[model samples]
Target: MKGRSRSTGLLLVISGASFWGVGGTVAQKLFQEFGISVDWLVTARLLTAGVLLLAVQFLLKDRSQVIGVWKNKRAAIMLLIFGLAGMLAVQYTYMASIHHGNAAVATLLQYLAPAMIIIYLVLRKQSVFSRQDFVTVSLALAGCFFLLTNGSVSQLSVPAPAIVWGVLSGVALAFYTLYAIPLLKEYDSLVVVGWAMVIGGSALSFIHPPWQMDFGSLSAEAYLYLVFVIIFGTMLAFWFYIESLQTLSPTETSLLSSLEPLAAVFTTVIWLNEPFGIYQWAGTACIFGMILLLALNKKKPAKSNDSVENEEPLRVS
Candidate 1:
């Protein structure tokens, strides 16, 4: 039974990561091929997914915690910050990256958050490096350089705006991973993430209303794609990931979640017919290697709570 459970968890985490990857491709199509805008999609996605996940949390998970965090003033403020700055920023910057570049590059760049987190910890004097940490940092930087510039230091093949957005996406993801820690410790991951979505959506809705999208211009397929982004991409992906964490450790889960970017690259190249070069492939391998190294050389990471305790709150949608 334990073997079967572990196998099931491996499958779930892989599928969840894969779904997130494919969903990004679908979103790219919505941006590149269709006239749909990122702001509109984000507003819709967060609001819809937020409501759905909150529904799940209330129905299947804890109900009181939904309202529980609000009773405390500091926690409530922190939740708002996490939602607006962390969740909304991460989602918006990521989609903007995809809007400017392909999903493959954007997803790969977002995966750089592990590197950013390491840098942040080092800056805060919270961590000291081992040989693997040095390797992880080197691989991450080299992977990013190759991925973005294809080994050219002076020139960038991808647009500069795209690269900027991608890097910002990574930074925002780091913030999300860090900011959600206290909230996750206090409440269920689902509860914190659900409300974060709602708060993020509500905040973005003020800037760009969800109801403002042109529904008439959208095809049935486009609508279906939107539904997939909201349901499968945002909601089920996170749900499956969090569920998988029940069986797998954070190190294992994080390593396996590298499948997210690989899946994005494959889907973007095969399904969307986006061009991917050999250098990009090597870069992807390097990034994946960093994750593998972390998992293998587990040294009680500086902030295990972000990954182990929270488990699945950091899904970059």
Candidate 2:
């Protein structure tokens, strides 16, 4: 049973990552088709996703749980941060990074959050620095270099500002992933995510008022893509992510999720006819190899072996 649960959790994490990858690509495509700016897309996505999430939560949440969060102002505040920083900040920085740099470079640097997660875990004394961890980080970094440079070290240079913003986005992502874990202990993951979306989306909506949104201007395809982003990208992906956090360490989950970039690369190749150089292929190989190593090298606590469970904030602006 334990093994089955672990397997299911692994599957869920992978699926979540896959959803994120596809969602990103699809969102990019929507931008191309709809002639919408990233700012508008980001605004629309968060608004729609937040409303849908809150609707589901309100209909499905237990009365007792609702009362608990209502009274626990501390948890409510923390969750608001979770939405603002964890969700909105990361997404916003990702867009900023791309505008400041090339999309490929932005994407590569943004994923540096995995390394940040490992560092934070080590600092918190959450886990010892296993050789496997080091190897995974090294391999992942190598992959990023290859992916961005197309395997040529000569072409690897990114704009300094872009690199800085991308790394900062990564840092924000790490904190968001870390700080929110504790809140999951007290609230249902769905309710927590729902509330975070509502709060965070509200905060971001003020940046671009929904009153300005032109619903009549949207094409059928664009609207369909929006629904896809809200449902699969924001909702289900986060649900699986929080569920995986119950059984996986921050490092474990982050490393496993490194597959997301690889998924993106493949999508680009298939959809955009992007060519992969030898170095890019090598880096991709290393990233996947390292992920497998981390998965197999994980240590289960002897006392807590039967426990399937247990479940941040830094401003990244």
Candidate 3:
């Protein structure tokens, strides 16, 4: 039974991560082939997924948590900050990255969040700069260099705006991961994330109202893709990942989650026919190695807040 449970957990995590990766590719298709705006897609995805998640919480968990989170003044403030600055920022930046570049590059760039988190912790004196940390950071930087420049310092493989958005996506992702730890520890992950999504989506709605899109122009197939992004990519992906934690260790789950980038790379290359050079593949390998090192490290970083090892953030594409 134990073996069966572990296998199930592995499958759930892999499926969840793959959904997120492929979702990004579908999003790319929407942006390039169907002319969907990033703001519109982000707003629609957050609002729809957020509501659905809350509905699940209302049905299965404590219904009060759906609203109880806002009763506390401090939690409310933090939620607002997380929603606007962290969730909204991450979503917008990621979609913008996909809009400016392909999904493969965008997803790979966002995976740099782990390295950024290490740097942030070290600079704050929360963690020591061990040899492992050194290698991790070095590998991330080298990987990023190769990915962007394709082994040359002067030339870039992708556009300038894409690089900027991709890097910003990583920064936003780091903030999203770190900032959500407190909220996650306090309330259920679903409650915190769901509310954050709604808040973020609500704010973005003012900027780019979901109703503002041209509904008539969309084909049934395009609508199906959009539904896939919101349902499979955002909602189910998060749910599956969190569920897998019930049977697997956080380390195992985190390591398995590496399949996200692999899925993105494969789908982007095979389905979209995005050109990837030899240097780019090497860069991808370096990033994967860095992720593996971080996941395998047993020592938890000493910090004022809860350790990151206890909870992995929802990696919504």
TM-score of each: 0.94, 0.76, 0.97
User: What are the lDDT scores of the predictions, listed in order?
Assistant: 0.84, 0.65, 0.90
Select the stronger candidate by TM-score from 1 and 2.
Answer: 1
Q: Please report the TM-score between candidate 2 and the true structure.
A: 0.76
Model 3 TM-score is 0.97
* Local lDDT at 199 for model 1: 94
Query: Which of candidates 1 and 2 is the stronger one according to lDDT?
Result: 1
Best-fitting candidate, scored by lDDT: 3
- lDDT of candidate 2 at residue 185, scale 0 to 100: 67
Off by over 4 Å in 2: 1-16, 61-63, 97-110, 123-127, 157-165, 240-259, 299-317
Candidate 2 lDDT by residue in tens digits, 1-317: 26877787788778877776667666656665576666666676666766665566567655466547868889877877788878777777776665555444455566666566776666766666777668878977886676556656676544566667677777877777677766766777666666666666677667776567788998998878787766887777766775676666655676667666666666655774555677767766765665566555665323342221233111111
Q: What ranking emerges by TM-score with the best candidate at the front?
A: 3, 1, 2
Q: How much lDDT does candidate 3 score? A: 0.90
**Each candidate's root-mean-square deviation in Å?**
2.0, 5.2, 1.3
- What is the lDDT ranking, best to worst? 3, 1, 2
Model 1: pairs clashing at backbone N, Cα or C within 3 Å: none
